[model samples]
Target chain A: MIKVSILGTGNVATHLFKAFSKSDEIEIIQVIGRNKKALLAFAPENKTTSDFSDLKESDVYIIALSDNYIKTVSEQLTIENKLIVHTSGSTPMNELSHHQRHGVFYPLQTFSKSNELDFKKVPICLEAKSKEDLALLKNLANLVSENVYEIHTEQRKSLHLAAVFVNNFTNHLYHLGSEICEENNVPFQILSPLIQETARKIETLSPYEAQTGPARRNDSNTITNQLEQIKKPELKAVYELLSKSIQATYGKEL
Target chain B: MIKVSILGTGNVATHLFKAFSKSDEIEIIQVIGRNKKALLAFAPENKTTSDFSDLKESDVYIIALSDNYIKTVSEQLTIENKLIVHTSGSTPMNELSHHQRHGVFYPLQTFSKSNELDFKKVPICLEAKSKEDLALLKNLANLVSENVYEIHTEQRKSLHLAAVFVNNFTNHLYHLGSEICEENNVPFQILSPLIQETARKIETLSPYEAQTGPARRNDSNTITNQLEQIKKPELKAVYELLSKSIQATYGKEL
Candidate 1:
């Protein structure tokens, strides 16, 4: 069985801990976090510690920390000759380069404390310095998820950026929709099915082909009406800019 | 049985036709369209006509045409004192006021010819000029969909505007993500789980509570890194503006 220790007590770390706990091929050696209170969630069944220097012996140490804390926390790990990986999309694998073996084990999904995620479907992006390390990471990743890819630092960087657009920015648009619904005394649930269908469409059709609306059609009359309806300046600007972008993207296709 | 005639042969019209076909309580007497070729899909199973004057007798007429064409199409119908409703989000119910009996039967979801939708889950927003007309439209809406709302013109205008943000604009964001994935040689499917999770999160949490990422956290380091990674001027602008909007939104909360 592959022995693993997870660092950080954030959503990603907690999720990885839970996912590894389910796999027969993996063993949770320890969970390290600076926040003693935050570590309580993982302390019950496994060894948990706030001291980074006194980490347990594990085959792989997964640092599931924030982007800024990744390098700092990796530097604190006094362990030697063991594989060290950070679960970050934007941060390169070399962020753990202080160690002899470094890699990236980023899960390309948003994690929520309240939600139960099926890790099997979550795509795990792996990167390592050596082929042996890569294979080891892949083996551990396969235990928890079926979708695994050996994405290098450059590709992972692009993936992270792309994710920000699709996940972070898309959620923001949902927020804007909710705000508009609230102002009009309409329940935000009215748009739930639409949101689900929008995501589902990309499964069968390319986002380019799946696209439809006033912007895609360049229906100037509806566009103008929508613009007039949006009272907030920021929302209006976003509406104008995105509408223009959609028109430009499809305009090129024709 | 509630007799209904569907006007136009667009995505909405065809989807409604398919939905009504499954319901035993709703009889689709005729499918009307100006384009003979487009009407062929429905011609095999039901009466299809191109001539506007040669319309069949039905309890209700559904004008599922483009926003601009709704009025013109309704005006062409010589039948009087019939429930003539338009399936449009932005077009006000009064757009069909020329008819003695006018209403709105808008489905609040994006319709695609390629996708098979569960009509029961689709939210059908109904509005009418009179109580009797409203009851008639609600009855027809209930025949196909389980989720029905009595949304007036002003409320529907906002709902449509909100939908543009959540559905249309959100799909555009997906397109942008796909472009980034292509450029980096990363399969767009990697982000699919993330996209789905983002949408699913709103079911349990409000969009404000569900929001996460660099902009939500105001992580300047990651935000700056992402901005630098985006090469195109237009995409860069979108990233910046959206990031700013997200920050502005959360900033007020603090």
Candidate 2:
């Protein structure tokens, strides 16, 4: 069995731990974190520790902390010759160059503790410093997912940015819609079907081709009326900025 | 049959024309548009004309023009006391109140001429000046869709604003993502699965409850790293604005 230790007990850390712990080919030797309580809660039935020195015996040590903390944590690891990997798409896999083997195992999906994840289907982006380590990363990823791609660190960085748009920015817009419904005393549920349809449509069409509205139509009058309808200060700013963007892309703004 | 005449051959008009024509209860009597080329392409089995006065014979004259042109088109119509409706979400139903029987038939779906619509599922918001006309509008919507609601003009205006967020702004972010990918030599299609998953997750969760990312965790280092990774000027602006919005909603920045 491949022995592994994971550092950090945050969202990414938690999800990865749960996913990997279920496998028979992998043995989680240690789960490390600064917060004793969080670490205890996140640690599986095998082992738990708050110190990196306690993880030297494992074949691989996975850093699942925030990007800012990864550099510091990597510097403190006691295992120098073992493979070290981080689960960040934007953070370069070379950040752990201090180690003999370095890699990245990034699952390109938004995760939450309560939300059930289908790792078998989520795309796992893999990268490593050497062929042997790359093979190991791919093997580990294959155990958890069906879609594994060899993405370079630079490509992964941009894919992460794209993720921010589709997942983070899109969800913020949903929040805005719910807020508007609240102000109008309409059930936010009323907009749920339309919201689902918008996302579902992209499965078959490009976002640019799916685009519709005042900016697409170049209907300056409808744009003016809709702008007038928006009462929130922050929402109005969002509307104006997005409008300028749409117009810039299509050159259809009035 | 409720004889209907459409006053524009734009995205909304073309969609509604095809949808209503499919229903045996509604007859598309004529189609009026300034561009004969566009009108001819609509391929309606009924008469097609460019004159607004030619709309007089239909039982219901539907003005699916832009907001600035709705009043002008209504004024140009020679028929008095004929049931007149405008297919606009932002424009007030009263804009057509000059007629004795005025109403609205706002289909709450993002439409494109090439994208065939399943009107049976689209939420059709109806509003009219009188109970009789309101009943007529509801019946008309029911003919095309299973989901029909008698929403007030004010509430429909609010719903339209909400759509600007989910449909328009969400799509703008998608555009931004594609631009970022194209500039970085990364395949934009790689992000498609993530986008689909983000949207699918919301079917069971509220956007506020489903929110995730560096911004939600208050991990500013990652946010700063993402800002540095972003090369496009407009995308950086979008990232900053959306990050700020997330922070504002959560009462902290990452």
Candidate 3:
């Protein structure tokens, strides 16, 4: 069995702990965090400690902390010649360079404390300094997730950036859509199927091929009408900018 | 049984044809379009007509044509006192006022010719002038879909606008994300799970609560880094504008 110790107790860390707990090939050695109360969620099932010095010797130490804390927290680990990895997309794997064997095990999914996710579907992006370390990390990742990739620092950075567009910015657009529905006394749930289909369409068709609506069609009439309907300045600005971008993207084809 | 005749053979028309053909309660009497070649897809199973003068008498006529063509097409129909509804989210119910009985049967989902959709989950927004007409449309909508809403012209207008943000603009963001993935030699599929999860999260949680990433966290370091990595002027502008919008939305809370 591969003994694993998880660092931090945020959403990512909690999720990783739960996923690893389900695997027969994996054993949770310890869960360490600065907050003693946050560590309580994992204490009943496995060892928990706020003190870094009390960390147990494990096959891998997964740091699932926030990006800002990753570098400082990894520095505090006194463990030598052990596999150390952070679950960050943007942060470089070298953030844990204090250790001889360092890598990254970033799960590319948004996590919430309340929502339960099937780890098997989540893509785990892995990176390591050595082939053996990479192989070991791959084994650990494969235990929970079916999708795993060897993503270097540069590629992971771009992936993280791409993720921001698809996840963060996309969610913001959802918020704006919800706002529009509310202003018209329509339930936001009406737009839910469209939202789901938009994401699902990309699985079969490219986003470029899947695109539709007034913006892509360059239907200035509907665009102008919709623009008049949007009262908020910020939302209006976003609508105008994105509509222009879509038109520009498909301008040649039009 | 409800006798229905579809006016256009577009994506919406074809999908509606396939859906109505499966329902025991919905009898698709005729499919009419100016383009004979487009109507061929539905000819063998159902009757097809190119001439509006040859239009079959049906309980309801569904104008599934383009937005601009909706008004003129409805005017062409010689049949009077029949429920003539247009399947348009933006077009007002009054656009079909050329007929004595007019209504709207707008399906709130993105449709593609290549993608086969389960109409059961599709939200069909219904609007009509007379109570009986709306009841008739609801019966037809219920024959195919489980989700139905009574959305008037104003509400449907806002819903259409919201659909553009969540569907059209959101798809554009996916295209941009794919562009980023391609530039870095990372398979765009790696980001698919994240995209799907982003949409799924909003089902249980509001988009405001589900929002994540650098902009939402106000991580200037990562945002600046992402801005620098973006080479294209249009993409850089989008990233900056969207990041600002996100920051503005959550600024008071932060």
Candidate 4:
């Protein structure tokens, strides 16, 4: 079995640790973190360490730390001429180019401390410096997930950008909706289904094809009325910008 | 059981027809459409002609048509004292103020023909001109859903605006992501988990609370690199706008 050392103790680390531990393909050789307190009493018998310098015996080294700290942690590690990978979608795999064999094994799913994730369907994005590293990354990804996609570092950057729009920006909109509800003394829960449905539709239909509403129709009256109704200046600004974009996309004016 | 007639055989109508049929809440009195073929397949006992003049009998009239059409269709109905409601989150209930006793029983869920909606969980937003109408709408919504919320027209409009951001605009971002992948000969499926996870996170955490990425961190190098990496003009524009918004949200600078 391939031996693996996982670094970091946050959401990404915890998620990968639990998922990999359940998998038969990889053995957890060590769980490394700077904080000894984070070295849980329940950690595996095979290995665990508080220092990255202590990790010398492993087939693969997986860095699950934040982007800012990855460079420092990678230098502290002892392993060389072996596969070293990070689990980040935005950070370039080449960020670990200091290592002879570097790659990325980014599970695209959101990780929360309390929530259990479905690894079987979750897409694992793999990127590596060379063909041999790619093969190793793919093999590890394939073991845990049915959806394994090989992405270039440059492409991953674009994908990451798109994800911010889809995820981060989208959630911001949900916040706007909730805020609107709060201002009006209405429960934001009312919009939850609509929010869910919008996402659900994108699974089967293209967003361009699925486009609807006053903005798409260029209903000026409704648009004006809506602008009048929205009290928050920031939300109103967002509404106007999005409405403009929608109009631009459709060749229809708002 | 309450008897209901559905006016309009569009996406909303079709989704509601099947959903209502599955629930033991109400008997569908009739299904009316502009096209004879669309209405022909509906249950004969429950289905009727497209003409509102030929509208036979029902306790409640649910106009599941478009916002542009709701006003026109409401004017078309001959019956006066009917408990009429339209299923639109964006359209104000006062739009039907000309009617004797009008209300909104908007199921604020996004509807797709292929996807089976979990009607029980999706919140049904209720509003009415009269107190009795409010109770009736709430009862009607409660039969099919556990989450019933009373939202005003102003808040619902804002919610609709927010929805356009999260659902429609977000999905558009997905399209952009997929398009960039297709152009670069990379599989778009790589971003699917990220997309799903992005939506899943909001179930527990606030959007602002869950925010993470280059934009939030003010990582200009990565932002510049991503902007240069993207080939499409629209995507570049979206990325720039969203990054600015995120920077603004996080009290960061470009």
Candidate 5:
């Protein structure tokens, strides 16, 4: 069994601990965190410690802390020559440079404490310094998830950026759409199927081939009507900017 | 049984044909389109007509043509006093004013020819000139979908605008994400679970509450890094604008 120590109490760490605990091939060696209250949530099943010096030896130490603390926390680790990694999308794998063997185990999915995610469907992007480390990381990731990729820092950065667009920006649009629905006395539930279908379409058609709307069609009448209907300045600005972007993407004029 | 005729042979029209054809309550009397090749695809099962004059009488006629052609096609419909409706999210119901009984039967979901949508899950927004017409439209809509809302012209307009943001603009973001993945030599499939989860989140959490990323957290360091990493001019502009918008949304400084 691969012994693992998860070094955080946040959503990603909690999730990783739970997932690892369920696996027959993995053993939870310890759960370490700064906050005792947070650490208590996972302490019942495994050894829990707040002191950096109390960390135990494990096959892999996953520093699932926030990006700002990743470097500082890695530098304070007592373990040596073990596979050390961080579960960050944007942070470079080098953040754990203090270790002789380090890698990344970034799960490319948003996590919430309340929402239980199926690790099997979540893609685990791995980056390591050596082929042996890479193979080991792949083995651990494969135990939990079907998708495992060898993503270097640059590629991981690109994925993170793209994620900001697809997840963050798209969620913002949903927020705006919800606002529009509320203002019109319409239930936001009406838009759920549309939202789900939009994501599902990319499974078959590329966004370029799948794009359809007033802006893509250059239907100025509908476009102008939409602009006039939007009251909020921020929302209007977003609608106008995205519309223009869609038009430009399609090689269409304003 | 509700006798209905569908105009246009686009994605919406084709999907509507298949949906109505399956329903025992609805009888598709005729399918009309200008393109013979497209019409041929639907000819084997139904009475297909290329000429507008050949349009037969039905209890309700659905104009599933593009937004630009809604008015032109509705004007050519020789049927009078019959309920004539257009399946467009953006087009105002008055676009079919030429007909005495006119309404909107907008199925508020992205329709693709290859994707067979469960109409029961698709929200069909209805609007009409009168209560009787609205009821008739609702009845026909209920035959196919569980979600049937009496959306007026203004509210439908708002919904349409929101749909643009959530569907068209969101799909564009997915396309951009795929492009980024391709450029980085990362399999785009790695991002699919992330995309699906983002959409699934708003089912329980509002988009405002669900929003997460550099901009939401006001992580200037990561935001700046992302801006620098994006090389494409259009992608960069979108990233910057969206970041500013997101910051503004959370009442944070750029």
Candidate 6:
């Protein structure tokens, strides 16, 4: 059995704790967090602590803290010759290099407090300093997820940036759509199916092939009409920039 | 049973044809298309015609042509005292006002030839010059879809613009993400689950509430790091503009 200790009480940490607890082959040695109250939801009082100096000996120690605190928290862990890992996509794996053995165990998915994520499908990106450490990371990752990759720090950085565009920017567009719907006294629910289908299309077709709009067609009249409809200067600017981008992508003039 | 004749043979037209063909309550009298090659997919040669003047009498005529051709095709139809409707979101219902009766049967969803869409869940937005014409349009809409709304021209205009943002613009973001993944030697499949989850989140939470990322949290360090990682000038511009827009939405400085 692989014994593990999870550090941090954030969404990623809590989710990791729950997934680990469910596996018979994996044992949670402890869950360490500076905020005891946040750790209460993950483990009992006996297996939870706020102290980092008194660390438990485990097969792996996962630091699932925020990006800014990853290096600071890793420096505080004085456990020697242990497989230490942090669950971050943007932060380089070298952040934990202060320890004898360090690696990355990043899950490529957004985690919300209320979301009941199915860990089995989520891709777990692992990176380690040695082949033995890499094998251990992969083995632990396979316990919770079927999708695992030995991603290097450079690739992981690109993945994180791509994620921001697809998830974060896409959500902002939805927000703009909602605002437009509200101003015109239309229910935002009307656009829900369209949003879902747009996501579903990329499963079968490439985004380049699936793309369609007035901007792609270079329909200047519809583009002008749409611009006139948008009242906010920010939204109008976004609309114009994205439209120009799309037109340029298709070798068309705006 | 409501007898209907369909006009055009594009993605929207073909989808409407297939949907209307499935319902026992609706009988498709004839399929009209200027391009005879495209009409073969919908109906046999006897029932499909290129000449709009050869159109047969029906309870209602549905012009599911492109937005630019809605008026041109509607003016060509010689049938009088018939409830004529055009299936377009951006085009106003009055485009068919030259006829005895006119209405809009706008299905608010993206239609593609390859994708099999569930017409039942797709919202059909209806508008007409008279209450009786509106009822006729609603009856035909109800035959294929469960979700129907009585939306006026002004509201439909706003809905179409909102859709451009959520569906078209959102898909463009997916393209950008795919480009990033390719450059990093990462399979775009790694980002697919994240895309699906982002769309699924808005089902329960508002887009504003569901938003999360470096920009939403105002993590300047991570944002700066991401911008530096991006290579191309155009992509860098998109990244900077969208990041700034997202930050501005959450009351943060870029």
Interface RMSD of each: 0.6, 1.3, 0.7, 2.3, 0.9, 0.6
| Candidate 6 lDDT tens digits, A1-254 | 99999999998997888889889999999999989779789747898888999888899999999988989988988888899999999999888889879999999998898898788888999999999999999899999998899899999999999999999999999999999999999999989999999999999999999998899888899999999988889999999999988888888432
Q: List the residue pairs that clash in candidate 5.
A: none
Backbone clashes (count) for model 4: 0
Model 6 regions more than 4 Å off: A252-254, B252-254
lDDT of 2 by residue, A1-254 (tens): 78888898887888888888889998888888888888777645357877667664887788988787888889888676788999998898888888878998888888777778777777888899999999988888887788888998988988898888888989989998999989988777767667777877776788888887787767787788888878778888888888878888888433
**Cα-based lDDT at residue A133, candidate 2:** 91
**Highest-lDDT candidate:** 3
Note the chain A TM-score of all models in turn.
0.97, 0.93, 0.98, 0.94, 0.97, 0.97
Candidate 3 clashing pairs, residues 3+ apart or interchain: none
Estimate candidate 3's alpha-carbon lDDT, on a 0 to 1 scale.
0.92
Model 2, B137-231: lDDT tens digits are 77778888888888888999899889888888888788788877888787777777788777777778989989988787677988998998876
Worst 10 residues of 4 chain B by lDDT: B168-177
User: Which lDDT value does model 1 have at B41?
Assistant: 91
Using lDDT as the measure, name the better of candidate 5 and candidate 6: 6
Better of 2 and 3 by TM-score: 3
Off by over 4 Å in 2: A1-9, A17-61, A72-81, A252-254, B1-3, B21-34, B39-52, B55-59, B231-233, B252-254
Pairs of residues clashing in candidate 6: none
Local accuracy of candidate 6 as per-residue lDDT tens digits, B44-66: 67899988999898999989887
Could you tell me the lDDT of residue B232 within candidate 6? Answer: 88
True contacts kept of 5: 0.89
RMSD of 5: 1.9
Better of 4 and 6 by DockQ: 6
List TM-score per model, in order: 0.98, 0.86, 0.98, 0.89, 0.96, 0.98
lDDT to native, each model: 0.92, 0.83, 0.92, 0.76, 0.87, 0.91
lDDT of 5 at A190: 90
CA lDDT, candidate 1, residue B71: 88
With a 3 Å backbone cut-off (N, CA, C), the pairs that clash in candidate 4 are none
What does the lDDT come to for candidate 6?
0.91
Model 1 local distance difference test score: 0.92
